[model samples]
Target: MAIRLDFQTEKKQGSLLITEESESNKTDVIRGFFSLFGFEKEPMQTTVYSPEIVVHSQGKAEEIQKQVSEAINQRLQQLESRPSKDEVEIKKPELINSKRTLNPTIGEMIGGAPQQEAPPEEPEWYQTGIKNKEGVPHYKLRYWCKNPQCRDRSNDYIKEDQKTVKCRKCGQKLLVRQAADEHMKRDEWGNFFIADKLAP
Candidate 1:
């Protein structure tokens, strides 16, 4: 059986017509050809006309129609070269064990398995709380000499109040009252510790 196909190209659109033939099944062949070249197939029939399949093409009609015609000719040649169903032999595929195959279960294939999560990070020692020599949590109090010209204005951590507080650099006397005014304050992260209040 032979199949007859016709096509026309216009300015903005292109169309293909498959003439009806009772000897062969042209619908499948036309559909496959249209799909291979990205064309849309539409069914059309009228009382006065024979049944036919129509496919519309987009883009440059001349170029698209030429390509579609070439593809259809090639497909028809291939179909002609293929052996008839009665002259061909069929073989069943060999079966393998489920374990040997890498096919995972539906649950695993769809990402249903729980993955190992990373451990939660621990806060740094300084951030948790300031510790004394005995490993007990304590507030850190800092003081500095008030004499501006003494060059001993650097801060010193005073853990306890003593009768005499003096700057180690210049032997200048430091008052506990002034130390209270220069106490270091820290934020939740403990990154910034400054006098009076936490750094902005």
Candidate 2:
């Protein structure tokens, strides 16, 4: 039986339509062709607007049509060459009865039994210091007022020189120091002065 194939090659609205003399009987074959060519399984009904196949480009439409024609020709040739149903003998598939054995799991292969977990080690001295929730250590230097009367103390993260800090009681500018032992020379006026140390 002859098959009629229609195609629309418009840039925006392109489609290919396939119609056979016995399309109702050859539904499976048509579905297979659509699947083989990566087309939608649902067939578009013949109408004033809709076409059989909708392609993205003109080249694709033409290529699909050519392929479909070739496939149909091949199918027809195969059908013609095949023996009649009465003359052909069908063999039933033989059933094999076998037990499916699963391979040994990783634990089974290693020791066969679950081992007890060891206790976690204690944290080191440095690790146990002042740290954030994420276990990151924060080292803050101590900053205190030099005035004995106003023995106010504060903690800061930065280590810059001459960092001015206001005392709560005296409200005087207190210079920051890395260590308590940092020497400060006293002038004749009794004012303490820090000598500038040159880089060696």
Candidate 3:
């Protein structure tokens, strides 16, 4: 029934002419060039091909002269660049050891070269008894697991007989003593706040 399109893209004065380059079958010439223009829409990018769909052709451009002679013999066999064995030119080896990481391709089982991330641990201030008024024992903070870049743990303690003051690492309600015997400030959520002027 003489259809059309097998490979196309022509902008002559601006440079994008591919008209059927013998792609042998660039996947059924990109599914018969989008089913000969009803635009089955699959291929993408030459900036999404639209300067009037590469200069008009609602059909009958000699019904794709055999997909334009197999896309002009596949663009003269890709302009005679002839080198492919999958064009052997691979070379990605320049990491000088500054801690080269990125371990992602989970397939052919080639793991084991990225186990060096253990250097960020300095925040464990425990002491939530909360007693701030010139008696010598303070630390009133509670609940700060919001995770601002992690690594803080004031889970605090000291409820021996004050009755209700939790936050042993995010339980939230703390402040069993606050007259300010003074000394404990981890704020911004990690909780623990008794700076009675840094009392003694």
Candidate 4:
């Protein structure tokens, strides 16, 4: 008996040819191979086939041939059940909009363009006209939240003795500095002028 395996793919196609010398010889070889691979309980008694066994053999070779044919047919059915290259549909990948932002917006869901947000205002100093015992002027700082995710921006009234201040909403540290009134010349109302400097 002869067996042939034909396989085809999208890029390549091939055929495999398998032949047996004789029915009895092929049966012995198949039994030996299966036993060698632990597929059978009995091991091959002799590596070489004897004339006596061949002459004495009645219907054993035919039985083994039938089993081998059934196994090959079952395997071919399994291969045929799989999706073939020609039967399978190839889909093109979806095009991603790189310009689109990761943050989902109401406008995006409604099929409208999203509105751009105004840039945050930078921190600025404001004098409160309050002075400590040492005559150092106190100032309030209006700053934006340092946290990228936080939008809470407000003024924090820092005490004269307080060295550090943080955002009340996000707990992010605020950069604060005392007004150097002693080092600057002030007008009659006691407001320090940035352009005027005191004598060394």
Candidate 1: regions farther than 4 A off: 1-131, 134-139, 160-164, 178-200
Q: How many residue pairs clash in each candidate?
A: 0, 2, 20, 0
Q: What does candidate 2's lDDT look like per residue over 36-71, in tens digits?
A: 445554443321222232223223323434444566
lDDT of 1 at 68: 45
Cα deviation at 181, candidate 2, in Å, is 99
Candidate 2 structure lDDT: 0.45
Q: Hey, what RMSD does candidate 4 come out at?
A: 16.3
TM-score of each: 0.22, 0.20, 0.18, 0.27
Candidate 3: TM-score? 0.18
- Which prediction has more favorable TM-score, 1 or 4? 4
Per-residue alpha-carbon lDDT of candidate 1 for residues 1-200, written as tens digits (9 for 90 to 100)? 23333433342223344554531344465555555455555432111111232334444433343444555566678779999999899997767652465767777889877788998776454443344657644443343455666544443333443334566666666444322234444544342222322112
Which residue pairs of candidate 2 clash? Answer: 15-53, 16-53
Rank by TM-score, highest first.
4, 1, 2, 3
Model 1 lDDT on a 0 to 1 scale: 0.45
Q: Write the residue-wise lDDT of candidate 3 on 1-200 in tens digits.
A: 11232243462212223444454544465444455544454433222132222222343333333444445455566758778778879998877755645754454247655677998775443333455446555454433333344323444444334434443444444334333334344455434432111112
Better of 2 and 3 by lDDT: 2
Query: Total clashes, candidate 1?
Result: 0
lDDT score at residue 58, model 3, on the 0-100 scale: 42
Candidate 4 — which pairs collide?
A: none
Model-by-model lDDT, in order?
Answer: 0.45, 0.45, 0.41, 0.48
- Residue 155 accuracy (lDDT) in model 1: 36
